[model samples]
Target: MADYLGMLKGEQLVSLSENFDYVTATADFVGLKLFPAVKTDNMKLAIAQLTKGGKIPVMALVHALDTEARIGDRPNYETMNVELMLIKEKLNQGEAIRKLIRDTGMKETESEILKAVFNDANNLISRVLTRVEGM
Candidate 1:
């Protein structure tokens, strides 16, 4: 929680943690050249919560004169997504949690504090994104 950094969604990257649906759901959710980080699965619950608060994903009207292309025997969008994910989403919060447990023993209200902080931060981020997108 120091100086801010940056993030994505698209299914170009898959984590063993997100094995619930098809491996390509993230990519399938968006078309092309939209939010480079277009994704919903990783934060599905968060977005849903914000939407319930009357927020929505930022959208655009893409207008192309010749938006036609031929499928070639080349790499697909998934490959690109994977590369983007490997480069972008590399933070391991799990390690942070482990260190907290080790250093503090996670005693007393620590567990509750951790849960509340994580949940609230996640929801707050979703709301912030929705608000920013609207602006």
Candidate 2:
């Protein structure tokens, strides 16, 4: 089994597997080029193999592409690292959305909605952290 990264794009979930076979199979079935996390040389070979196996290459060249060929926004690692650090700093300082909302004197309904949003965001962050730790 391969550890696949799944990105949500609108109503579709685009999954990219680390395994070359898995990616090739997916591409063969869906008629989409699923990029694999491999060296440029290997990637080129994989692309050629997939094409030879009757899978249409959605992307021209794996090494030449600036970003991953997918429907969703590619994750910016640098931005994510900076934002994670900022979130940690804020948490350590006891800063939270509820406090900000209270300080700003938001209306009751608006405050509730903001609180819910923040709660969901925190949960998502926690889940991400857990996954990272497991890795």
Candidate 3:
């Protein structure tokens, strides 16, 4: 069985991969040509986190994106949410996540931080809690 970053059972990961195969594949195909480094870094973080935990780093990515959106000209909230959801789904699949990250070309430390951010569900929840508390 593929290690899938050592995060999930092979069967589970495969099922998740199948569920979002089309989007993931297309994203990868486009990402390779259009936004190589960025896509690669995101996927790498996703897979590494999954290997260490069993899920994607959804919350962190969402938070990061939210911050980015806020700093820039924000788009419609729902649209951004949808985009993030697709990204989250892509991150859940080991192979897809691996390919995305590999194609992006992120540094080791950036990958490490992403993996650490999503090391476990609780960690993600805690981050949310902290952010909420601050707000």
Candidate 4:
């Protein structure tokens, strides 16, 4: 398996843990191009070095996107707000939620619930990102 370095918005850098096939699947699921570069022998060290000066990790950013999709209730969203805020700069929260819905292969009738989820996730992500940016 080959490891590749992926960058989002030029600031967020992710280390692809899988080979080409799995990387493609992950990128499609996340709706991000994730431009790949040369592989690093020690990704953790590379990430730490790259993110020096208080920068966040790419894995943490990916977790934020995943969190938005899994947040089912107000309490969950509230609890995970800090984690989500870290990746606000890396992705468009609304778009990421919508892409997740579209990628789920759901039927039209079920879209109502999906739309609601998308809206909720979008609102939560937007609010948290805004708050984090202002801080």
Residue-pair clashes per prediction, in order, are 7, 0, 5, 0
**RMSD score of candidate 2 (Å):** 21.4
Candidate 4 has what TM-score? 0.21
lDDT of 4 by residue, 49-125 (tens): 22232343323223554356443222111111122113343333355544544566345534453344334444555
Off by over 4 Å in 1: 1-34, 38-106
Which TM-score value belongs to model 1? 0.24
Summarize candidate 3's per-residue lDDT along 14-111 as a digit string, tens digits: 65545543333334243345533333323222211223333434333246543554343222222111122221211243565555445654355444
TM-score, per-candidate, Cα-based: 0.24, 0.21, 0.18, 0.21
Residue 100, model 2: lDDT of 48
TM-score of 3: 0.18
Highest TM-score: which candidate?
Answer: 1
Q: Model 2, range 1-135, lDDT digits (tens) per residue?
A: 011102112222122112124332333322123323332322122111222324333445444557666453333222111112212412222346446445655455553543344344355455444444444
Give the worst 10-residue stretch by lDDT in candidate 2.
Answer: 1-10
Q: Least lDDT summed over 10 consecutive residues: which range in candidate 1?
A: 1-10
Quality of model 2 by C-alpha lDDT = 0.35
Root-mean-square deviation of Cα positions for candidate 1 versus the true structure, in angstroms: 18.8
